[model samples]
Target chain A: MAVCPDFSIPAPFFYVNTFYDILYQSEDAKRIFGEHANFFSLIDVESRRKFQRLAERRFEPQKFELLLNTVQSPAMLFDIHLKWNRDNHCSILCIEQSQRYQQITEVLTRFTQRLGMTNYDLLRRKEELERLLANLQQSNAQNDRLVELGRIAASIAHEIRNPLTSIRGLVQLLAPNLTSSAKLSYIDIIISEINRVNSIITEFLKTAKPAPPLKEAIPVTDLFAELELLCHSESLLQGIELVILPVDPSLMIYADRLQMKQVLLNMLHNAMEAISDLPNSRTGMIQFEAERFGRYVQIRIEDNGVGMDEQTRTHLFSPFFTTKNSGTGLGLSTCYHIVELHGGTIDVESTPGHGTVFRIYLPTVDKKPELS
Target chain B: MNATHNNRFFQASLDLTDSIRMKIIQFAHILLSGDERKSWEFIEQQLVNGIHSTEIFCTYIPLAMTYIGELWIENAISVVDEHIASCVCDYLIMRYQAQYITPPDQQNCQAVVACVDGDPHELGAKLAVLLLNRHGLQTHYLGVHCPLHHFLAFISKWRPSIVALSVTQSHHLKKVQDYLEALQGLPYQPEIIVGGRLIHHLSYTSSKGAPNKQRLFFMQNLHELAGWLEQDYLPIKPE
Candidate 1:
């Protein structure tokens, strides 16, 4: 043990030889070692061997000398070195490392705090990035939809122009003829074509306009019953089964009567097209059922027609995705928009060749009807 | 009184026991057949008796039905048809997960199971979650094609013990590598374990510049995965 010249008693400093005794026996020594102090004494034989190997690699002789000599400040330096002595006792050089250790601890604490702040900043930035990404994706989807709408509009315009040109030519060709019946017939044909063109234009324009507000308390059963009659008549003509389940009388949707009817008609037309073809034995079933959901009236139109695959189902409500031979794909797309405008959502569930179910939810009127 | 007792009480009890036994046998057969709807129905019926679907599906069904489909496939069942069956079974399993009301024990080790980006087949990942959950591990399932950055953010915040990644298709190799590289840079990186069909597609060629740079220990199927999880990955102690 090292001794001070001025004192007759021991200096209370732990020397290299008595270091293990001090670390194991003294609470003050254990406090300096932290949680690792117990590990030094309590480790089993195999663990001690492994730890010794690691310690040897980490605490080399040159690094030990540097650690001891680097303390220039007037503070207790505890150079804790695990070494073997002549007596084969575990020796730890307990020089006063307090001042240098405090400096290192302060530097490390600051670094760790800065690291934590950086991590928090990174997290905030990541959240912002995710939000931006989600927005970008939504915008891209909208852009794609707009482009598809534009294409459909161009084709529709071209179709209308061709018919208009034909009507114009027919009018010009029949200009010289002067007969009452013949003129009336030609005028009737022209008027019908003009009406068709007008209807097409009106439907296309409706897509851009906000849905008209609900003005009337229309009976849900009556509306669905009328739809059922129409579907049944169409089915009779086309040799297909059109089934409408009994509508729930309590399920009244607060919606514009004309707009809601239009939505239902479009869905019914789509269903008719879907099931138009089948061998008589494997003919598809079309069903329309109404049920009252919480705060909303749900109308489900299900078809056992050739149901769509995932890819088709994903874009099923997108404007102008049609498998029809001579029909505008705008039908269901318009229905979807109108439903959305009325504070409602449309969901479709389908399995290929199994069936499709289109569920439309609309808010129900619970309060007294407002006079318009 | 003796005749009444024999007719009403003793006979009714015997009938009830016979019905219960019969139902259980039928349920076992349906499970062995891999009929999802029938299995669900059986599970619902057994609910009154307090039998859990998770226990039946994870233990009994997999043990008996694992090789049933293989035999059928060998005897001329189409591969595409097998995929459809797998899809149905996976869907049912997910439905059960959705409907499961009993809260998983939070005291157990928690894990995040996800499919690497571009690997859209989620059946394998779903199966892994079911098996892990059966073993009493809490699992947070992030479905197929989960973006890498989102996963990293979740990992940092949640700090789960294990991150189980599934890559079903070979096309997701680049994305998986990118995910691993990103994980290496994270502050709270968990122990990463990967499996699925894509691993089988990877070769062990030692040539430089080849796509297969490292030998990923591939798990053949869900059984292998369950074994690996139970033996090597469970009971993770927090650092």
Candidate 2:
């Protein structure tokens, strides 16, 4: 240890005296200087500022710790006492300590302060761990659901593909002799049916595992036109009025065009079906509207139809949860999936007696984050 | 089992010897009669009581199948009787295969068990498929006379660890060689396992000196296959 020649002492004790802006402290005090070399310098910025303000008051003595340099030492403690001396025109700050404190009360006070800090740190870590655990559990549940979907899809695909393969093989045999347009249209129908089956398989796979969207800026007005054209015939047949109200002609969202169409068409079909299902829903109206709020474009498919009960509403977004007698239960689930893939959400507001409003929020093109 | 128990399922467990065999034979006959309600009760009971599935596949069904074939030889049952018995037994075997309990993380040494080109005997190959699958290997049983093209396609898609070929007649031994040649030319090589009635006559081995010689195996039964798999393929640790 480098000794301060003027203040060197043999006892393993510490003392500090302040006079004329010069600190005469014991070797043990010097050893415990946290960073600065002396008692006045050892005080942190906020504490020194507080001392400066308190120093202005008459008969006010500030009691603060001059933190020791604990970097190169073990078994440290600090005791700082400041008092204003009216006669001497100076402040006196004393640091009195030892290898161990003489008083049990002082030890207990330090122990209590450390315990409080440790407890707070422990609580913060526990909360963080619990949050992480909850996230992990949710992700695990999602994965298990996806695996189950894949298993079901695999079995269905196997059963369908055998007959499909046989039909396709027979069609190949018929293709060589076809020269007439009427026969050619039959071939076209077969090919289209095959493509539809393929599409169903693709949809199943999408639900089995979520994938990044093949995104582009798609205008809401254009999408509204597509939905109208597709559902117009069905609406007339089912005696449901399908209305398209385009609030923002220029509102665009970043999403897969085909996927967005499927989502809209699926929702519109469900709306029309819901309207038609009601015993007194002959004068049913299904309305489509698009509007922008903040960074998102909100597309609403509202139906004055048979709104769902609370139990159905709670399980509305879950895959394979359906209220309809013959529904496959993938209608809203797929819509929810596509919106999520585009970094958006699907929300519903409905009650049993009234009607249901399905609101889809897709972020505007400019607001969409850059996909990695 | 008590005589007053009324249930025929646990009757197999009543006796230590030939009684279990007799009980199984009676159930097999019951299944063939298409009385599913009566048959299922006994079958489900045996399965639920933790009877090993291999006991049914390896012992009970084979004995009943042989007995039915013997009845036909003695002119006791007609050809139609034999056909119905075989078909019913096959269906029941498949039903049991579907419900057989396997460990979730079971070892999967992928195997393709099928009849060679021009071989009509599928029952043996089907049993082998079930036996391998039940022992925790992913197995595909392609029924009778798997042509070279289909065989190649199955091999390419599954990339099985073993290609188990079965041929019942001696005349189909030459087809085995052609199948081996086709398999050997493929990019991914799966080991060929040849077996059936005429397996010994073909001298099926990895050697080529014999005329119908090919790299093939002759597992006398599922027991031998299980033994080989346990020695080499099974996972070192229980999962």
Candidate 3:
């Protein structure tokens, strides 16, 4: 009995067990349908054909969306469920309900104002999740590094002790056979070899305990400029090309300028070495680009050198992890440590024959007060 | 609510200057960093007590958290940042909902709110549930995309005086229609309400249906819904 003009609920308040017969409808059903018509009959021609298929199959009453219309009412779509029953004489049943579509559009405009806030929060949580995962992995890697160091410590002590003992006995034995000058020369040779060993140990210590960078606001553009000038001679000597793309002059990062130079120089040297090691290596290319991205400044150094294999790349940043022989195997590791100290992330991409790319992201320095 | 009162409330509650808007965005970032304590404190400091808290929440969301889809299109914020801000807002809204107290003398009218299946957006529906409850209506919240069976089972058992169904996706509009179909045979007839972001484009609603003789009240926000409940349903003492 309650009704409004913009929306309608015109279900016939009647039930029919058979759609094919009208006799089954009781007087009340007849009266309601006679005036309002059966909800199914109110549907358009196309839908009745569709509804007939279900009735023909004697399927259970199912809801089919149809636009219902009557002489006095406007055309509106309703999910009307209809079925025919023939077991006891014949019967049919119908129901219809709908709202003005405009109502929903208005509601959506209101809801969108709120949904945006929910979305922003979800992304923040995702970033936290990634950060937490990274921290867990770093901790595990650190524990592994400690275990490796303990083993290396024992081996190093044995290696050094054996050499000193051999030198002591040999020196005493030679003391009787040689002139004073000859003895001094022989002792000098021994000292030189010992110094070589000491240098290797020093490299290991430097990697084991890295000092934090003294951060200052330095322009990333300047870093790229200095790097190009520094590597200019090296690139030419190795038949390599150095490309430095123009970047925003004001783009600045809070990092130790000296350490950042070291990070880039090491990467450039590695690129050259990789190219030289390859058979029939063409003229090498090392491209460096610096730019500000969101709250960070990114420095990307790419090279056309023989790249690392998956196995070598995995341990590329670990302390004392290196592919080069005849060195302490800690060049790249030292670079990584310096970058981390500046609150930056380093990512490396390499393909066996294709090339290598090192992308460094450093948090940009903002002197302005953060509102929140 | 009168237009003058609405305007006054909006102006008083959301004086969202550029600086305040920027600060709100910064707070969203802080909230994302899991500094819940600091974010709430910042909000409290900026939004003083004289402003109706709900009005502030309703009016200022547009400034602080613009439509995410539009933001992504404009490249103003990454999809992830927008998503994070949205999630933080949802959490804040839920925090507000938890503190909303029901009046002692509740109305006899009971309303059941449920989202149609396949539509997971529940913020609007949840707001309706919380606001209705605060206004002394006995409201039950059946969360996002409730299966049709569960919805019907609860409706039959509780026999609520009204039912609010929310669907945020157009594809899920079918579910809304299906629900209306199922609601037809109930002995205790309840007023049915459907809401969602894509509710306007609900396929069936596109038809040019002229005014019919059945009553259905459409509400765009809690304010409008609140007005209807107070004016028609709730008892009003002489003012």
Candidate 4:
């Protein structure tokens, strides 16, 4: 009723005894194994152990991969399918599976190599991330400290300013009463010292709570002229070269002129101090430049002086962070606040042995605002 | 969102047409491939080229991360790839925060941004803080896994005008409710703004709006947050 499909053309099939002794071989098997009387002779030595393990399992039909010697080769891999008959004989079918296995192994090896490449990339990124995290943690800790200091300094400055004002007033009131020359000099010195302390407190308060800028459109050249006039004596005394690159007189910025000048003067003072830190052999130079870039006016101040290390640079703008023994460290922080108040940004780059450059970017004003 | 506000939200050097979508795809690839260096370079170039920080952090980064998440869900990317992308994103955010200089805290309206007590996802909260700070709010960011007691103590000490809480999943909502209940007992009640992925859940709010009677706002995204600030907070804030 049913037609039997010929399966001999696809694979070699044979019958074997329970001992794996070949009873009959198909034409395909004969061509493959070449007149082998027993299946044991066609099996490789390494495959004998695999065959033994396979025999220990249930005697139901199963498929396995084993190395079998062919007529023209010493050993070849094939898929061995075995089914047990009621007479204790086994019918076997053989199909090649080694080429597929080799292909899979090749794919796996390539995949492993790709994985290794990305693993290396991940490791590199991990190290970079660690460094970034450490730097961030340090910066955050410093910020916390500065915030606490600002809170304390605001109240302390208030208390100190009141007393300072009374002392100055009392001393000024007593100044005329001291007629003796020696006493007059002492009074003069006391007044000036009080004024200095008052100025320091003022700067400290500015860092704690900065006043909003009184915006006005001022010419860059005018600011540059005032700066040169203000710093002429100090640069001459320190014998440091102060170069102001020429700026177009038309270029202007809407900012608080007083606060802007204060920022420049403070930075120039720091540049002078940095220059003083180095030996007399090196010629200290400070270069200032202002230019219009896009919608912003960039102010650059560079100094050839004893530059800061990364540690100092990291906390350079913190309210109370200072590298100098006598420094209050409010100068740069106040400058930072002033620039930020003007909707501007400040950036600094310093190398330990080379120098330092500070760049301040402020929105440009094309035309001056009319005064009310 | 209004078209004008949406435009403002995505204000960047490149238009958010096909270009931004392309950028998102490129960014996702860079992140999933674990190319941290390239990711930074890409971000830096964008920042340098006049792309707003909010657009990059709030829009672009979030979009890229969402794509990465979707890929992981679809089995297109391995779990390891997702983790690597998350790590890279975290590092970039931290690095950006570290480098960012918040404008002087002249605003009297102080805000406290924190994740829920048990929630570990903080990128959204961090971005919120950065955006709020950029908009001139004095924001204190209490990062991931902030315990209830410690957060309460900080809230008491700081007495912020607004408390912005973030949660990543629906499971964290109960904890957020607990936070709201505890905050109600304080001497001064601060307006609360709840945000993050949990808010997008269908049950977080009803058609009638937020369940709480207190001054609470549920923001859907950074765009909504920005719009809210522009409408209510920025108008009142003194320069």
Candidates arranged by DockQ, highest first: 3, 1, 4, 2
Every candidate's TM-score, chain A alone: 0.45, 0.46, 0.43, 0.46
lDDT of 1 by residue, A1-372 (tens): 433222222212222233233333233334443333233452322123323433332223311211121222211233344544444334343445456656654654574355334433354467679887896687678669777987788677767766676776777577557364556555544655465566556555565654465457676887887566446777788766778788767667777766787788888777776776544557667788888788888889898777788988987887656677665567788788888888999999998877788999988865455566
Per-residue C-alpha lDDT of model 1 across residues B74-187, encoded as one tens digit per residue: 333322333444444554565555456343665544778889876656666777788777666787888766788888888887777677888755445545666666666667
Q: What is the TM-score of chain B alone in each candidate?
A: 0.59, 0.72, 0.69, 0.79
In terms of lDDT, the poorest run of 10 residues in model 3 chain A is A1-10
lDDT value, residue A263 of candidate 3: 84
Retained true contacts (fraction), each candidate:
0.00, 0.00, 0.00, 0.00
Q: Candidate 4, A237: how far from true, in Å?
A: 49
Once model 1 is optimally superposed onto the true structure by TM-score, how far is the C-alpha of residue A368 displaced, in angstroms?
Answer: 3.1
Best by lDDT: 4
Better of 1 and 2 by DockQ: 1
Kindly state the number of residue pairs that clash in model 1: 8
3 or 4, greater by lDDT: 4
Docking tier of model 2: it is incorrect
Error of 1 at A325 (Å): 6.0
Where model 1 places Cα greater than 4 Å from the true spot, the runs are A1-215, A323-329, A370-372, B1-239
- Residue-level error in angstroms, candidate 4, position B175: 2.5
